[model samples]
Target: MDRFGDGLVFVVALVLIGWWIWRRFDNWLHEPPSSRLRKLAQAGEVEPDEAVDFLQEHGYSVLSGKHRVPLGVIVDDGPVQTTRLYFDYFAAKEDRYYLVRLERSRQPIDWTASGLRERLLPYALLFPECDGIIVADPKDRLLRTVRFRVEDEKA
Candidate 1:
């Protein structure tokens, strides 16, 4: 009976640890990328317009296109599905279009990259002519350029 009780306690402890790990991961995954960027901007690490103007100054023309696609409903069917649409900065020079997404933050480098690839990549795809995406972190004074095949669908 003592052995069985010890085994049960061990199982319960393992389960609790697993639950805690899962919850931490879920919270990290759902954290907003913009939160970090805002912090960087506030600290004056990088100017928002500087990042935007960098692409334009490089001869990429800005494409003024906005899209609103359904994400999901909030509460019930009564409030229709909605999505917040933002303008994606695009500049076309010659045959290549540069889709630039500016994210300002004073966070860890790895976190910035993870957020950029996960969040901004899809937004850049919305521009059909965009051959590459620039994820610029103003706070770090770092820029990561990601190129996509022309055949890929623009999200």
Candidate 2:
């Protein structure tokens, strides 16, 4: 019966391994792009908060203030909650509002305008009233302003 017990043990081990692999794949599939961006910034390649501050220092007024304050509206005797919004920067003289998002990598050359555009599109939808969005790579001091195109869905 020793052989029979060994076979059963192997089967249980295989099942455990399969479960672990499946869990990892499931997590990877559901991971958000923001998580990847944060990892890049944490590697000492970029400063995301600094970029936001730069925008504010340049005269951009944050709509909901820092740290995304929760604004609620009462409906049906319950609070309707919405996300707190913050602007990266705004230029009052030019009537421009900027949403600054950061991207970073150890190999700065890999960074591209298209990649930045892909990340900022969601923010544009979130802040439809903003004049523009700035995808800033603080490590490289590279900033690209994507003009808000309310007419274009891609923006």
Candidate 3:
């Protein structure tokens, strides 16, 4: 009787494990494709973009340009407003992906810590996989990379 009970338990355990594996496999198979990074990587362009050239000159390899992600914001539980999070260029250096944002004359960047957090932190938070963000000012020839680190504080 004990032998039969052990066999039954073993069979049940196997069935549970198989069910969990199937669930994982099904989710993986039906998961949505990755964002534009894959598509841009696949597209081989003969013509070089100016932004790409700028990045290359600064020692970074440009992967793609004009990357945008659709964003929806709801304020005060009101209707959702659609906008875009625009990335001027995507580049790599030292095997790390960096999202590039070109500085515009009209909307100058605030170099202060608070201003930097308000303006640029969203990009880093949205793509936690990315190493950081590179802000390039072609006119003034400035290239800056920003990274965020969170440390636990002992209270």
Candidate 4:
């Protein structure tokens, strides 16, 4: 009887593990780029202050790194919900707002899963509100904009 109970427990554990793996895989596929970049910025691998300085030197007036504002729209079964979008740094110059992403090179140098467009499109949706979205690689001393055109928010 003990042997049977152990076998049942093992099978149940295996099923649970498999389910968890599936959920993780789904997240990896659908997780937006902005979220990944935000995580990287928060990881402390690269100093936020350094990135802020870089943006400043390049003519970006850094406003704040984090803030919640009623900015985007989300449609659901219930009702249209206004979602607050997050950016690493919100900046402006000449009365223009831009959502900035500060990426500190943590890995050796690779773009396997994380690509540029995946992250930029979401920020672009803030069109008219924000002039555009810019991504900064402080370690590389490079800055680039993700030009926004109409596109789906998910992959």
- Each model's Cα RMSD: 18.2, 17.4, 8.2, 15.6
Which stretch of 10 consecutive residues in model 4 shows the poorest summed lDDT?
37-46
- The full ranking of all candidates by TM-score, starting with the best, is 3, 4, 1, 2
The TM-score of candidate 4 is: 0.47
Cα lDDT tens digits, model 4, 1-155, are: 99999999999999999999999999999986555434433433323578888998999877667644466455676667676755677777776667777665562323332455565565665444566777788878998765555658896
In the range 1-155, model 1's lDDT, one tens digit per residue, is 99999999999999999999999999989986544423322332222466556655555555432224346556754777677644344445665555555664543324455665566556555544455766566445666667644465786
Scored by lDDT, model 2 comes in at 0.55
Q: Assess each prediction's global lDDT (C-alpha) against the native.
A: 0.56, 0.55, 0.81, 0.67
Candidate 1 lDDT trough over 10 residues, lowest sum: 37-46
Candidate 1 stretches with Cα past 4 Å from truth are 1-49, 63-79, 106-117, 138-141, 148-155
TM-score computed on alpha carbons, candidate 3: 0.69
Judging by lDDT against the true structure, name the best candidate: 3
Worst 10 residues of 3 by lDDT: 38-47
Off by over 4 Å in 4: 1-48, 68-85, 104-115, 150-155
Cα displacement (Å) at residue 131, model 4: 1.0
lDDT of 3 by residue, 42-100 (tens): 44442486666778997898876776678999999999999998777777788777888
Q: Candidate 3 regions off by >4 Å?
A: 1-47, 152-155
Please give, for residues 7-46, the per-residue lDDT of candidate 2 as tens digits: 9999999999999999999999999655543332233322
Give the clashing pairs for model 2: 55-89, 60-90
Ranking by lDDT: 3, 4, 1, 2
Give the clashing residue pairs of candidate 3, or none. none
